[model samples]
Target chain A: MRIAVIQFPGTNCEHETLVAVRDAGMDGEIFRWNRPEQELSEFDGYIVPGGFSYQDRLRAGVIASKEPVMATLKEEAAEGKPVIGICNGFQILVESGMLPGSGEIDLALAQNVMVKGGRIVRRGYYCGWTTLRHESLPRRSCGSFLLDGGALLQMPIAHAEGNLVTAKEGLIQELADEDQVIFRYCNSSGTAVDEFPVNVNGSTENIAGICNPEGNVLGMMPHPERAIFSWQLPPPGRRPPGPGPGRMVFESMRRFIEVSR
Target chain B: MRINLRIWLKIPDAEAATVKNTLVRRMGFEGVIDDVRRERLYSIEADVGNPWRLVKHIVRELVNENKEECLVSIDELDLDDGYVPVKVGLHIEDGEAISAKNRLVRRLGLSAVKRVERSNIWKLYIRSDEREAVAEEIARKLLINPNKDSYEILRARARAVGMRQ
Candidate 1:
């Protein structure tokens, strides 16, 4: 199986994601944004890796979403090809109106909230390890197959505007009902919570990742690729003797493709 | 023709007050000065011949699609006049506005002042005769952040006949 890692001008996570894909035993290739749409469509699966695309100008992922490649990516996703967007890639997916399968976008990853003294203000940038748990759903996708319900996975999150919000009420419930919500911020025991420190960016319902209604396109803020190596984990006790939690993400995708064939 | 554009957030007065107070308190200002307004937004300026098509494209492509309403105004200018007035505004919208204001109020002391709004304005200076096409291309392809804001073009008047300054 071959996976295409889409690279935008400011994307920095492509190399790492490519490494993770190759480690999972799938052929991985880097596809620049400027490449022709026909060439990009050749890949069986795609990953829009994270980075400060377009300098995070006009909101993170806003400018990149309008690029020519996204038009083709959107089309590929519509045909049920697996498309995973990590961090900035996730932002681009939402900005491009691909995730949640909302047809129209009414949500955004707003500025982070920082509580100082007693007042809440916008936080600039944050980077650290976070725990995520899978949300049980009947519709299976390669991106979410391995994550058992309530299983905890350690990952890193680095961003400023990571707070997920929607202007409309009940949107969170709508996503949940659709089985689009795939991951939630949780404690070590895998209990989902909305309180801060545990839920770093204050996402609604502690959502860490989500897929579209069709279950093919996934967008998540955490850096799963960065956690593929055991040493990448924080603290000695949390580290395992083998590959880290991130391997499951890629492995699941590869497994899904192999099984489907 | 040269066109000046003003963009601002359509925020409620009550909410704007909270933002102004927070800026003054957090940034260590001696209260907001008379001319400066507070809000997180952007401004852009480009010189083009016809301002209509450019502003229309900007509104369609660059402004926010959500209910976070934004206004873009083209200041009235006489092509013969050399000076143009430019303004821009940025404001937090929907739930964010209230959340930001509440957070600021909680952290900083409350203030008696009622209203504060945020936006950005752009001043475009054009000397060329081919304004419409150039401006449209610039607005559609070059301007930034169309998904989070909105825009408009104010009709130009003939320097208001003979007005008393």
Candidate 2:
């Protein structure tokens, strides 16, 4: 399968994403945001990677969400093509109203607000390893290849505004009921928790990632592509032998493409 | 017509204390800077002929009415037919502002100081009189984020050829 990694100016993770896709035994290439719409149709999957697009002006992903490329991405997503957004790319997806299947912005990845030393603090930007647990819903998720639901996966997250919020109260519950909730921050035992620094960014419901209702689009703050190799793990000695936890995500994406074909 | 635009956080102290404390504690500069409050401001100076119409469009497209408050004022520049300048200030919520102020005042030892307001300023210049549409488009598309901040049109007035004489 061939994968297209979308690159917006200031997006720094496209190369990593491409490498991950190639490591998974799939053909991968970079697709600039200004490229013609026809070029996107040739790829079987797309990935919007991380970084401060448009210098993250106004708000993270706000300007990039209005870019011309998103129109085509939205169309492809509607056709059941897999699209994954990571970190700032996730912000763009939410800003563009692609996640949760609403096509309207119902949620926001707000500034990271956490409790430190008994008081609320804006952690500004955070970078470190985190544990994630997949949601255990009967419905299939876009990225669920190598691991079962509730399995603990260690990943890295680097961002300033990653907290998830919704202006309308009680909407998070609706997302859960719809089986759109995907990965969540959890303890080592794989128990999802609402406390920090586990739920590092204080995302609503400790959400680390989510997929659209139809399961073709996924948006998450953690950088799974950054952890594909066992050597990338924190404290090299702690890494288990063989592939890293992040490899499963790409492996799953590759499997998803193969199955779809 | 000329217009000045200002965009800011809805709460005056939204950016206060947060950065100063971090700078003082994390960066090891406890006493170097006595106090600091960060604010964001957007200034739009346009030579568009239709000030009111432009203001209406800008308010609807650029400002977030639900999260922020905006005010419009008229400018009286001495020059005739000169562009009206619009100033927009962004602020956060009232309670958050007060709490931030209290934290800064107590921690920074600023009893003698009256007020500390910090903001960011963005200036937009419209050079063409006939291309008011371009100016309006810029304001609507690039000026602000409707999610958490608000803006105010501080002043707007039409420039007349007679005023130049």
Candidate 3:
């Protein structure tokens, strides 16, 4: 399938995302979403890469969502084309209104385990670019993939505002009711955490990603692009990162496009 | 992961309101409901990241040197009300924290305490008025000679408690 990766000024991970897509052996090109008349029809799907768009000044992805590219993508996504928003990309999708509106998710401010311990630990992680050793990340990330339910994925995260928030009601049921939630944050043992560390980002029901009403658009905080290699899987001494179910998310989308032809 | 004491204070006053506002702005919390009540009551209420450091900073601001004589006047009021301005203890979850935390507890002659991971927070707890003494102790340890910085921290801490409001 022909895929286009949106390239914005602060989007640093577009190239890596492109690498993952290309390595998967699909026709993929990096497109600077700002260029005029950037036709969405030129590609079958679009991938929004992650990074500190507009410096995350007024909340993550708040600015980039207003971009011309998002405006176009949102329209096309509504018509049934696939769009994937990752990290900052996910934030952009939410801001752009491509995904279901969060209205107001009560956020809980907390710190990364790394910050508390004064160094990075292999066990616990949250957003940003870092080498992830996962046998289970794929599973965590994909467990909620496009499923439209609030859940948690043991996915790696690296953002300062990675905390999850909900407004009005319990965000889990709301998202699940719409089938808008796509991923959740769970512990390594495939269960959710209790209180303190549940869904590291504090996402309700451990949700890590969510989808639009149509389920054609997915926004997630984890980096599935980082998991393109098998060697990166967790070590043998560790129970092994387990099967990366999230990979199938991309693979399935690619297949979905292929079957349409 | 490793700590001696920690705490998470839900400040209730204007002093805390100012600091809370500053923090919200600094943290870049956008679309927040602007107001001391809404701003102070941030939507993203989560566990305290570093309870000890958090309290220590608050103590520093509370004890910071400032001309806002009300804090000292409060002491006089305490005396007039028949209460000695002795120090109070602030239970901490982590012992090894910013000097401000240790300084406040030690300086005020307040006992330092700890809790196991099962507790998930600081082991010590201090009464209302004693917050000043513990905060002053933290400032002294930092060698902020004038005690101005210490009082600022204390004011900031008490503000959250609604005491300095």
Candidate 4:
């Protein structure tokens, strides 16, 4: 499968995403988003990694969302081609009005409240590595909001504005109805439990990932590329391999390509 | 590679996490590994693009918007003999409302106030230096004509935290 990773002005993770795609047993290519008019249809799918594209001007992903390439991205997303965006890329996706939650994300932009009901306002919340486990349904949080909702997967979340915010109907709920939420921020057991530190970013309903209406487009904040191997484990303790959510996403995309072939 | 800015804040854990998350998620760095327990160490891998420029832009945004999170480096903070917990707060007012004027800090009886850009919020670069002296300087300078309720709250907090001047 030919995969195109979008490289914008401020994107910092394009190479990592590139490595991720190549590691997934697929042909990974870096494509410049500035060259939006280029024939991107040749690639099987596109991955928009994270970064302050255009310095996150006028709000995160706002400028990049209006860039020349996004016009083509919107068209492709409409066509049901698989597209994945991580972190700021997800912000761009939402800012461009591609995600379900209106256009802007009402994210909680403070420190992580481990055990939400705390007296002292803590400082660092997005640090440390949590064991990723698949959720029955994907949920949004301050960590990852790029994965599809309603799917269970374990992926490392890293972000502050990752708090999933939606339009009037509660975008997360609407995505849940379509089984589009593909990731969740849950306890080690994969149960839909909410507590301090467990949910990490105070995402609504512990939502960590979500998908487009067609389920073909996946966007989440967690870096699945960072967790491809067991050696990457920062003392996984006794957790098993079922919750390696990154592979699930990669596998799913690979399968989509395989089936297409 | 990432630059380190050492500032003091109310909370450590949550603020560190939030900043790191912003670095990795919104800013889209490979990752940010903590250095030690010093609340400043961050790691970001090289990207296809120039990350230094990106980091500079992201850091400026964070410092301007996230006043409660960012600070000037440990080295810079050490220069202030008073050991003030200095968190550089840059307050944005209208167009070119503020500029980096070190002499003004001295003239207003203030040690130093790092000012940059016409951002929305006051980017207070608070460092863990001489808290008392810096707070006093702030009181004398910026707090001279204060916002009633807000200043009252700040005064109370500063007094409670043993702010000197």
Candidate 5:
């Protein structure tokens, strides 16, 4: 399957994401934002990789969201093509109103506010390893299609605006009821805690990732491509040499595309 | 009393240029908007005797004398005409503003500083007759994300009645 790793001006992770896609047995290429919009239709799946697009001029992802390429990406997504947005890519999707799939701005990934013990501990840019528990069932979402519910995967999240917040009432509850809440920040043992370091970015209800109602579009704050191999894993690596937990996300996208066809 | 510090870059503001470009070229505000300029507004609520002396210290702490220009006013914001000044600030907890308040009080020993509110003033020079309506549309569309931010249209008011420096 041909996958497009979309790149904006400041998108730094496109290369690694393309690497992860190829390693997952999918043919992939870095798709620039300035590219012809119709050319994007040739790709089977799309991945909006992370970076500070437009140098986060107006805000992270907002400027990039208004681009014409994103409009075409939305069309591709409507065709049930798997569209995975990682980190700033997630912000773009949310800003573009693609994550909720409502074709309207429904939520925002606000500034990171790290809270612990009912007090603000830290705020702003943070980069560190974090664990994500796949909250959706197997095949429920394209990005986590192969991951079973409650499956814990370790990944690194580096961002300043990963805090998911919604002013819309009952939206979080609605997402939960629809099984659209895909990944949640969790402890090593897979408990979705609501505290700093565990909850990570103080996202609503510890939510790290979410999918649209159709499950084709998934937006997540963590960087899965950063953990595609055992060698990329954090220190104290005693396990057998193999693909890392993050490989499943890409692999699952491939599988989802194949199954859809 | 409130100390309002309106700070703008002495150099060309790339952020404002980008916003103007995005709004005009991308979001289809080409004809409606003539230009977009931005200024950082810091409203510090302080109870201090010899307010002028205290403001000097506050300016020294907050305003970078190089590559930035500041206009100090007290009580009211007297913005220039020919543009609609839209004030955008985080409706949710603003950590930066909180930090600024703490810095002035705890670190700088400006104990009179009771609060500090920070906001971006987007000065939109609009060509449309319905300036306020267009400004609001632009604010909702491109400026503020309603989830965390809110915007206010700062209409022209009487000049600063308290003090101006």
Candidate 6:
């Protein structure tokens, strides 16, 4: 399957993301944002990788969301094609009103607030490894298609505005009922927590990732590409040589495309 | 009493330029939007006697005299008439503003400072007759995300009864 790793200006993770895609047995290339929008249709799937797009001016992803390329990407996504947005990419999707798939702005990845013991401990940019528990059914979402429900995957998340919040009432419950709530920040034992470090970015209900109702569009905060290989994990020398937990995300995408076609 | 510190970059503001570029080239505001300028506004509520003297110290602590310039207004916000000023701020808990308040009170020992509220003033030089409407549209479409942020359009107002610097 051919996957397009979209590389917006200031996108620093496209190379690694592309590598993970190829390593997952899918052919992929970095697709620049300035490229012809129509040319994007040739790819079987799309991945909007993370970085400070448009220097995150005016807000994290609002500037990039207004681009014509995003319009085309939205169109591509409506056709039931898989589009996985990671970190800044997730912010872009939320800003572009593509995450909820409602074609209207419904959520915001506000500034990070690290709360512990009911007190604000820290805020702003943070980078560290986190455990994500798959909350959706197997094959429920494209990015987590191959991951079983309750499966925990370890990945690193580096961001300033990853806190998912919504003003729309009952929206979070609706997502949960629809199984659109895909991945949630959890402890090593796979229990979703609501505190700093365990909950990571103070996202609503510890949500780390979500997908649209169609299950094709997915937006996640953690960087799976950064954890594709075991060597990339922390406490370096002690870990065994093998594929990392993050490999499943990419592999699942490939499997989803194959089965969908 | 409130001390409003209006800070603007003496150097080129890349954020304003990017906003202008997006409004004109991307969001179809080409002829309607002539220019876009931005300023950081920090409204400090203090209960100190001879507040004017204390403002000098607050300004010293907050404003960087080299790359930035500050305009201090006591109890009111006044702006030039040419553009529509839209003030955007986080409706949720503002961590930075809270940190600033703590720094002024606990760190700098400015006990008179009761609270600090921070926001960005987006001055939109609109060429349309419906400047306010267009400004609101720009604020909704690009400036503020309703989930975490809220915005207000600052129209022309009577000058502050207090002193201006």
**Which portions of model 6 show Cα errors greater than 4 Å?**
B157-165
Q: How would you encode candidate 4's per-residue C-alpha lDDT over A1-261 as one tens digit per residue?
A: 788888887888888777777766888888997564557877878888877676653245655665667778777766766788887777677666666533333221222334465532332326445544444332222122334543444456666556554324554566777766656676666665565566766556776666665566666767777666544556656556543446556656776656545
What DockQ number belongs to candidate 5? 0.83
Per-candidate chain B TM: 0.29, 0.34, 0.19, 0.21, 0.94, 0.94
Better of 2 and 3 by DockQ: 2
| Candidate 1: regions farther than 4 A off | A114-122, A236-240, B1-116, B122-165
Q: What value does the lDDT take at residue B91 in candidate 2?
A: 42
Cα lDDT listed for each candidate: 0.66, 0.67, 0.47, 0.51, 0.92, 0.92
- The sequence of per-residue lDDT tens digits that candidate 5 reaches over residues A1-261 is 899999999999999999999999999999999999899999999999998988989899999999999999999999999999999999999999998889888999999999999999999999999988988789999999999888999999999999999999999999999999999999999998899999888999999999999999999999999999987888846666889989999999999999999
lDDT: worst 10-residue window of model 3 chain B: B37-46
**Residue range A46-107, candidate 3, lDDT tens digits:** 88988877666434675565566776886777667778888788777765656554322222
For each candidate, report what fraction of the true interface contacts it reproduces. Answer: 0.00, 0.03, 0.00, 0.00, 0.72, 0.88
All candidates: TM-score = 0.68, 0.70, 0.53, 0.55, 0.97, 0.98
lDDT of 4 by residue, B34-72 (tens): 211112212222232333444444345434344345443
Error of 5 at B141 (Å): 0.5
Off by over 4 Å in 2: A238-240, B1-107, B112-165
Pairs that clash in candidate 6: none
Error of 6 at A19 (Å): 0.4
lDDT of 5 by residue, B70-152 (tens): 88887778888789999999998899999988888899898999999999999999999899999999999989999899999
Q: For residues A1-261, could you state the per-residue lDDT of candidate 1 as single tens digits?
A: 889999988999999999999998899999998888788778889999999986775468866777778889988888778899999998989878887677566667866654434445445578888999888553355577777766688999999877787766787899888778888888888877666677787677788899987788889999989999898898867755789899888988887767656
